[model samples]
Target: MRRGASASHLDAAAAVDAALPAWLGLPNNAEKVLLTLRAARVAATARGVAATALGVAATAPVVAATALATTMAELLQRLFELQEGHKELLQRHEELRQRRM
Candidate 1:
């Protein structure tokens, strides 16, 4: 949270602010959106894993298993995406919050 942003820009800032749930290191305002997404996806995976173990139908077990496998694959893909986004955002945040040093 710096200064001079209008309501709309402030809203955008706030949105990003909401995304970032934690702040470990920064000179200025940073770290939000990506962290929230990460936490959500991890929670989703755990839920999905549990759901997969539950009995659903007799004839549809194969279909269900396939869907569960596909979901797990997509979940993994999204996790990788978050890792890359985190790396990129960390660099950008550092650049934005620079100081004379």
Candidate 2:
């Protein structure tokens, strides 16, 4: 059971990893953020899948899953914040560059 479950989990992960390049190729900033959110959703799914694959009814996996889900949620939130910060940083850099010109 563990072996088969492990193999299936690995297959799912490989499928997601394989599609990463296409996600990265998105041409627009909004699309990229959407892609990141998609990736985070995949990660959350992966955590649950992994827990189920382990076939453990233990509390540890449950706790871990909760922690992982929270972490992924926080990551998704930060991704948006970081995107805004990045745009601001670029604007400031451009302003400084213009001033020097």
TM-score of 2: 0.39
Per-residue CA lDDT of model 1 for 1-101, tens digit only, reads 44655767979877775543354354332343455565677766655564557653333435444565677668777877776687688778778778533
Model 1 stretches astray by more than 4 angstroms: 1-65, 99-101
- CA lDDT, candidate 2, residue 40: 71
lDDT of 2 at 57: 45
lDDT of 1: 0.61
What pairs collide in candidate 1? 19-32, 19-33, 20-32, 20-33
Top-scoring candidate (TM-score): 2
Native-to-model Cα distance after best TM-score fit, residue 50 in candidate 2, in Å? 7.5
Residue-by-residue lDDT tens digits, candidate 2, 5-55: 999999989887656343657543554555567667766676666567667
